[model samples]
Target: MVELQSGYKLKKLRSDRGGEYTSAEFLQFCEEIGLERQLTVAYSPQQNGVAERKNRTIVEMSKTMMKEKKLPYKFWGEAVNTAVYIRDRCPTKALEKVSPFEAFSGRKSGVKHLKVFGSICFCHVPNQLRSKLEDAAVKCIFVGYGKCEKGYRVYNLQTNKITTSRSVIFDENSLWDRDTQTVDSVTVQIRSEDTSRSSEEEHEETMIDIPSPPQVLAHAKCAAHIADTELYG
Candidate 1:
């Protein structure tokens, strides 16, 4: 797929010694395709640290994106896809001026149309699909970008599936639930009360507790008495 899209044959594939890469079928396929498999030693990710670190970076970024927008687990695949898309477009020190996407695709990936992943959107329904008196737009959650079309992909709540629309009105400031949100099954955050209380307690513990002047005097006297008793006895 990579070779077909990029118009350049994949010469070498570098990966860790995973079962998927080491399997007979995969090896045979690679040999037939005239591609070299450069496998690192088993359990030594340091040999392939660049690939490992990139995978970790993508996963962490995906997690952050989902959490930041209060997106559900069902949208994790979309989040990961978006993460890779964003990562490719991001400028890296490895490449001067051009992004990874630009370096590979020979053109810059425009960011002008990027929108919040889980923000609420209203997709315009065509006149043929809607009745004369019926509403023209449907509420949806923006999932990702349209691959085949110049539009945004959104998950329709009423239809319970994803659909792409170029005429998408996005309210980036708002999420799926509009001005307010109730307890949503797929997206609500369940935090431990004990953990919250413990954090508050920890904050309090960090502050200096100043003793009263009388208490200070008493403490000083007690220390002096103990010292004097030790010296005398």
Candidate 2:
């Protein structure tokens, strides 16, 4: 896709001697395409420093995003995808003043619609999917962007499914607590009296304005710093 968009013909392929890359079918395909294959020495990642560094950067960014949003590790794939999506729009030393997206597609990338990854969101439920008396939106977790569609990828908490929708409302300030009984599969039974008491307690806790510890605050600051520097540098 990149080569096609950039109107460039790929000449050489450099990669580690992974099984998938070393397969006979892959080698035949490359040979047919008249492309040279360059394989690094076994167990030597330094030979592929650029790719390794990029992978590490993506992983680190994904981890930071998941941690900041208090999202579960199960959403790591979504985080990684979102990180890559953001990275393509960010300026890089290799690309000089232009971003990877612009360099490849010949057009500047826009970030106006980007939202906080893993933030608590509400996706509008289509009228055909719900009755008039039912809620108009479903609670979800903002995951990433739709690759083939102009929409946001969200994790439906009620249905335990990932869905894409153009209509989504995000609450960037609030994160879903994973420890709470939010998943539909895990049902918690409570007595009528205990439910009322717990509701009151939850309200009181919500009203309390507790300050985050210095360590957490520092971590968040550091994450933001890294994001700005590595992504936009």
Candidate 3:
């Protein structure tokens, strides 16, 4: 798209010997564009110092974000994007106090829409489509701002899908944890009932009827006396 839009035929393209850049289609495209493709030596990343530095910076920042937010490893992509997004707008000594966004676009970047990464967010469900039993809003974990798409990247626990949303309600305070309400309550109640039932059963067993030794002896003596009297008569 850039080649087509530029209208000026590309002259030289310098990059690492990556599969995408070295593919036959890319080679053909470069040939068609009258472009020179220059690839750096394999394993000699020092030759590509700028790209290598940026990659290192992104990796370090991404790790920092994940560690800080306590997010899952699968969210590395979102962390990388957030790291790049913030770095792109941060002022540096080389840029003379001007941010990368300002330097590139010649305009100041807006910080109004910025949010904490991994914050809890609630997205409203359309009322017309929502069922009576369904919640009015769906809970989500904020990942980062979308690049190509015009929305924020969010992770939905219920759906297990990382999707984009234009509108959302954010809760920077909350963190994700497993819900144990019903199960825990039910287990406690069941244990209590079991304990009560066990105590009652124990009390009933302790009160079981048993004939006294004195009563049994007295009944046997009376029978023997009656038999003796009948034999003598």
- Model 2 C-alpha lDDT per residue in residues 40-110, reported as the tens digit of each score: 99999999999999999999999999998878899999999999999999998888878988887788978
Best by TM-score: 2
**Per-residue lDDT of model 1, residues 16-118, tens digit only:** 8778999999999998989999989888999989989999998898888878778778888998888888888889888986799999888878888888778
lDDT of 3 at 123: 64
Model 1, position 29, has a per-residue lDDT of 99
Global Cα RMSD, each model: 23.3, 15.7, 27.2
lDDT of each: 0.74, 0.79, 0.72
Q: Kindly provide the TM-score of model 1 when superposed on the true structure, using C-alpha atoms.
A: 0.72
TM-score for each of the candidates: 0.72, 0.76, 0.66
Clashes of each: 0, 0, 0
Better of 1 and 2 by TM-score: 2
**What TM-score number comes out for model 3?**
0.66
For candidate 2, give the lDDT of residue 228.
48
lDDT of 3 by residue, 1-233 (tens): 64565465567877898999999999999888688988999989898898889899999989987776567798898899898998998998889999988886678988888887876676655547565445555667889998888778898877889888886766554455535311111011112234556554533322323333233334444554565468777
